[model samples]
Target: LGIGGVRLLRALGLNPQVFHMNEGHSAFLGLERVRELVAEGYAFPVALELARAGALFTTHTPVPAGHDAFPLDLVERYLGGFWEKMGTDREGFLALGLEEKPWGKVFSMSNLALRTSAQAGGVSRLHGEVSREMFHHLWPELLREEVPIGHITNGVHTWTFLHPRLRRHYAEVFGPDWLRHPEDPATWRVEGLGEEFWRIHRDLRAELVREVRSRLYEQRRRNGESPSRLRQAERVLDPEALTIGFARRFATYKRAVLLFKDPERLLRILQGPYPVQFVFAGKAHPKDEPGKAYLQELVAKIKEFGLEDRMVVLEDYDMYLARVLVHGSDVWLNTPRRPMEASGTSGMKAALNGVLNLSVLDGWWAEAYNGKNGFAIGDERVYENEEAQDVADAQALYDVLEGEVLPLFYAKGPEGYSSGWLSMVHESLRTVGPRFSAARMVREYLALYQKGQEWAGKARGEQEVLRAFHQALPAFYGLALRVEVPGDLTLNGEPLRARAYLEGEVPKVLRPFLEVQLVVCRA
Candidate 1:
């Protein structure tokens, strides 16, 4: 009866010490816990006091514009019954799940989460400082740096997702111990996989290339391009030749069009003496035509350079294609504008299969990179005009390829084979490749999200109900909602006329509404 939301948690077989919310996503659970205790014969004041004892929250944004707010009436509609049943007044109800203060006149999820959660955080160290200044209103008494938005830098789950063959190849490179002792990825260094593992990796890469070639032919046939022509073209592809792959979701921020900045520079890089080729495989969201258009422009360039057989665009890409391209490529190209990328995962996969990175300094690459480990493309200065940055970075990329990478590929010996590129390949595999992975990231998430083993969200069930209020899975609650928007209660806020669209559904299969305090609800 005294335990606030811990009662619900205990009911579920999880014993709780605290609660944790990912974002504004779970703020209402705080209020729900308080109300549960209040309903179970505890005074509302005592329940409210106990509610703040053990909780944590995290936010991911740094600017005020990123926060969300809703009309006050929206909160009233959902939680009105919960507060009324708990005998709490309207002012008290408005203050339960969130709060907004006088100075800034903002309703902040970061604020609610920080003030309510016993511990709170931002996703990175730099972001945590930015967030402290951004959400200083939540803790009016504390200095910005002292405000408890702890930093837990983001990570990925690289191995859980490694194609089994890729994982095996990694085990051979780093030894079985690398998986257990990932924190020090240099463990692979002492064991030293040397040159033999690279050979097996290269052969596995050939197998993946064949699979991707088959897929490309399949897609070309569907596009009304000749299936027989595409099939015949597959035979001409250079599986033994160095193949570069560029595959990621084609968001504009990624600078997917960077390679086309200089026609002459690209002409030199692509049509090399070593006959290096590219396989571009990625998809823009249906709404994102800028990236899709960039890809189409690239298609035209293959014809322009007269490297049609050498360079190809594999479309209609999915997870399966992503796996193949990562494993098959000699190098994975990621040219996102510097510092904008927030922990790219494709590069990690490439590292696993001994495919080196040709990427700008951004996201995980910024952390994992040694110039010798793979290829680094740009400087860290944030440019005001993106067009200027694109031009500069693209030129740098062109220079690196033409001067360094291509020369290495073409450099021959008495044996009539180039071996210079192999040094960089070995460096990538030994250094940045093994360390930047998802297992390390997942361990970081578990530590930061769990809050020193304080949260029991994995346990607890349902919070207390005053009179055993029941609902169904398809939640057959008998209620009527009819509103004439502009004629009904006006939304009297800034710009004064936010649009109201009325929607109706008969017998919907879920609970109808959610009420949280002081701001908007997008859920």
Candidate 2:
């Protein structure tokens, strides 16, 4: 489908100077481009080189199973015709995507993309590092750090996600400049919004509550629940209460059940003086029975404990429902397992709407969470076991909510506003709003394309020099460095130096193109 789309565009005279693959699914486009080049009398190597120079691939998966791979026979059945057209035999064509397994042959789309693209990347900083290690076999000629993959943190389309009421308020207060200059964080004003901000938010919450009541009533009627139970739907949540929302695709790694880990603790928090309500919505993949079961368990627990008045899991999650949750909820909750989430953007949407995020320090939050801007779930600790990690993180979630979030949210004054909490909301919007906008993401992608084009231009007509340099790249990649460091250092206090040793040798032919870098992580 991706190749067909690209070919169709080309047929209409749309020549893309830089082709970007968001994930492995679109990798076949690179092969299609190669076939086009080969038709123009270019050798396979030259075709591959030219096609790669104009290609960029971004991989979002952090786990092996998440990638797409097909067996050789399957690929032969589907894409066999592509080989002859590209002037390659089956063996030569298969080499582009073949996995080096000791077992049966499989052609990995990710491998194909990595081999055919000038650059590749993951969605976030940590994911980029993970991707380099995962795809190292594809680039044995380069160290993980030297792998062409880089990162541009994912972002949300702010204008699309911001609630209409908030949008109007922003325009009224800051005028039209903020929309055009969204990259300028200072342009978004939180001052003078004051009571008007809370009023708009209160109205959004009321709207969300009404929508939830209508949906719940309809769902009960469709499921044939008792008339009395169906009638109870309208009384589900209070618009004035402290509301937290959790909604996303129910992938197991997202840990939606983390909040329900300690049922009694959660109940106590909900039943406290500063009582809170939760709005939950998500859908599991049809084949993901465990994910479906986990979601059902939480919903069942909510009903079994008579907490339905304080919590409700909406059915059939969609964009409309997502807007209500993000715009209406007081806090947007995300608790994905550490290092597994690849740049979750729902929290960014929520932040732009002036809803504060309370998430695990993972994905975009790893970079966006300033201590003063948004709340983090736990310390950055890597546990040996998932069970231990879950327990520790669950406890941390409860602690933060009880000790900080709820207290501040309920600390209302004569003006009927939680000034302290509102201040944090202002800071969150001012800080993360601009940083995680789609405008910024588009700029980063264009910059990457420009950089790739420049490098491709540099290599043209220098093929003889490049060929020798490329031949010696494997030996250069095999080189290793060792460093010794002190066990501990003070925060912003010490200038530290480490002893280093270099190992391995590169071929003399590529000395001019080789350089080594030693970096210290200031973060």
RMSD of 2: 4.9
Judging by lDDT against the true structure, name the best candidate.
2
Task: In model 2, state the lDDT of residue 515.
Answer: 61
Q: What is the C-alpha lDDT of each candidate?
A: 0.64, 0.85
Which pairs of residues collide in model 1?
9-460, 14-459, 55-118, 69-520, 70-519, 70-520, 156-438, 157-438, 158-438
Instruction: Return the TM-score for each candidate structure.
Output: 0.70, 0.89
Off by over 4 Å in 2: 87-89, 101-103, 456-511, 514-523
TM-score: model 1 vs. ground truth: 0.70
TM-score of model number 2: 0.89
What is the per-residue lDDT of model 1 for residues 109-195, given as tens digits with 9 covering 90 to 100? 545455555567765555566667777766676767677777665544556655676567567756866677655657556335545
